[model samples]
Target: MSPFEKFLKQLENVKVIEPTISYDNYVTIDLSDKNPDLNKELLADAEKFEIYIEDYLQKNNALVAFGGYNEVRNLYKRSTIFNGEDFDERNIHIGLDLWTKEGTEVTAALNGNVHSFNFNNSLGDYGPTIILEHLFEEEKFYTLYGHLSLESISNLQIGDEFKKGEKLGTLGNAEVNGGYSPHLHFQIIKNLDQNSGDYPGVCSKNKLDYYLENCPDPNLLLKIN
Candidate 1:
């Protein structure tokens, strides 16, 4: 494994959601094209997609349905933001998504300071996002929290400090969170260039290798499964 990957894997007891919710209450979810239970019919609208999630969680006897790291999804086809001017068709999700109810408390996976935050008020975009800067034994990295409530960043400043598992924000609803089910798009970024507040959570096929390396599986820290 790469050094960053090693650093992430060695970290222990990281939780980005409600601290009270144990990993046992967290169930893995598959929104990829390979999941036979998923289809374009249910993915066209946020309401349908949410119902699908609620059903899955209910079936699994869980509170949170999380997955989607390095997962290719069909939902991005509805948004032009994924398809840049060149029409590269970005569909692979690079961040780990935790699906749950709106207003659910979201926390930091580790001690960090706010690197940036923004309200990317576009369809299929992260409504309210916060990026935290962290350093582990001289290995600097970042953690991004997307699909957050507007109130999350209302008083947040660029360099705000937060300890591990501290309340960083809450999950947003479909109206504000890029018109999707309420969930937290949590990611670990090793090298952030000039981008702040926002980074590409999904990538095109050509850039998949780079993203997968830069943004490794966040489950390494969360250990949800």
Candidate 2:
């Protein structure tokens, strides 16, 4: 079976959200049309906002599809709200985002060893992130789960073992999760190269081929139409 098929077979009991929350409901200041500074207060308290998200999930206990960090800054602009930083097309997103509340449970896509974990607490960076290494059918690949709460890595160890669909950590708020809307940025990486807790979630147009080859569409494994 292919990598996507293998991952689908393992997501039998995963919980997810349908009709992900809209981008408008994600931020506080609504920078969709404004040219604000990177540090502008466009988002609210993650902890407080997550309460509603949690309640919504309980009412709509659907299949857990996928989870990771997300941003609504329209990465394709080649320039971000962050310090007027200009980037190439590679800066655009190439991953799937699972929209939900803060503190949402993040589970592993498959059984794997803890490759590395870190607190990437920078402006617009993944607050706390985790990467897993999986070996299936002699094919090795990595899963990157970003924007996690600090406690997620509080007691984590390098090379730790985790089972498929096991709880890894809770989603973090905008303050702690790199100042953006609450969502998971999930990606399937075929080659890790030398990356650690963080990998390129966004890439430029020039580097699209490299990213596409190394990181396939997460939906292939999620199988969520």
Candidate 3:
């Protein structure tokens, strides 16, 4: 196994989100083409899309929904920033999205220091984002929390410390979270390079290999499944 895989195996007992929300309360969601239920109209309207998610959670008696790591999706086609020819179209999600209600508290998966954060105010983007630097077993890595409310980063500094399972922020709605359903886009990045506050959570097919390597599956840490 890869070093990262071994690292994740070591964290099998760690709790990432709030303890009240158990693994049984977490449901897997598919936004990829494999889910034939999703269509253009359903995904176009933020409110409707959110309702769809809520219905799913209610049916399954789940408190939160999660999935979408390296899955190709059509949800980004609405934004020119993603669909435009500036570069290749970026529709494959490299992050795991935890879908829950707005204002829901988000917590640190492990002890880490605030690395950087910023508001990426653009259509179909992460509104308020934060990145934390972590060191484990002599290896360095980073964690990113995206789609957060503005208040989450209002008083945050570059070096703020957070213990494992400590409150980090709250989920933001479509109005403040780049016009998408309220969700936390969590990713584990091996290299941030010079990027701050934000890194590519999605990539094109051509760059899939690089992203799949840099950003490992967050479930490796969460172990929700």
Name the top lDDT candidate.
Answer: 1
**Ranked candidates (TM-score, high to low):** 1, 3, 2
User: Model 2: per-residue lDDT, tens digit, 1-225?
Assistant: 555556655655442222243322332222222335323222344444344444544556632323322224442342242324364433456567665667778788778899998898876677799999987668788888888888889999999998876788888777888765566777778888898998878765577777777777676665554
Model 3 CA deviation exceeding 4 Å by range = none
**Deviation from truth (RMSD, Å), model 3:** 1.2
What lDDT score belongs to each candidate, Candidate 1 first? 0.91, 0.64, 0.89
lDDT of 1 by residue, 1-225 (tens): 877777788889889999999888989888898888777777768999889888889999999999999899988888889876876999999999999999999999999999999999899999999999999778679999999999999999999999998999899999999999999999989899899899999999999999998998999988777
RMSD score of candidate 2 (Å): 6.9
Clashing pairs in 3: none
What is the Cα-based TM-score of model 1? 0.96
Question: lDDT, candidate 1, residue 152?
Answer: 98
Report the lDDT of model 3 for residue 34: 71
Query: Lowest-scoring 10 consecutive residues by lDDT in candidate 1?
Result: 36-45
TM-score for each of the candidates: 0.96, 0.69, 0.96
| Tens digits of per-residue lDDT for model 3, 1-225 | 578867876785565455677788899988997788789998889999999999999998998999999899999998887887578999999999999899998888889999999999898999999999999677789999999999999999999999888999998999989889999999999989999999989899999999999998888888888
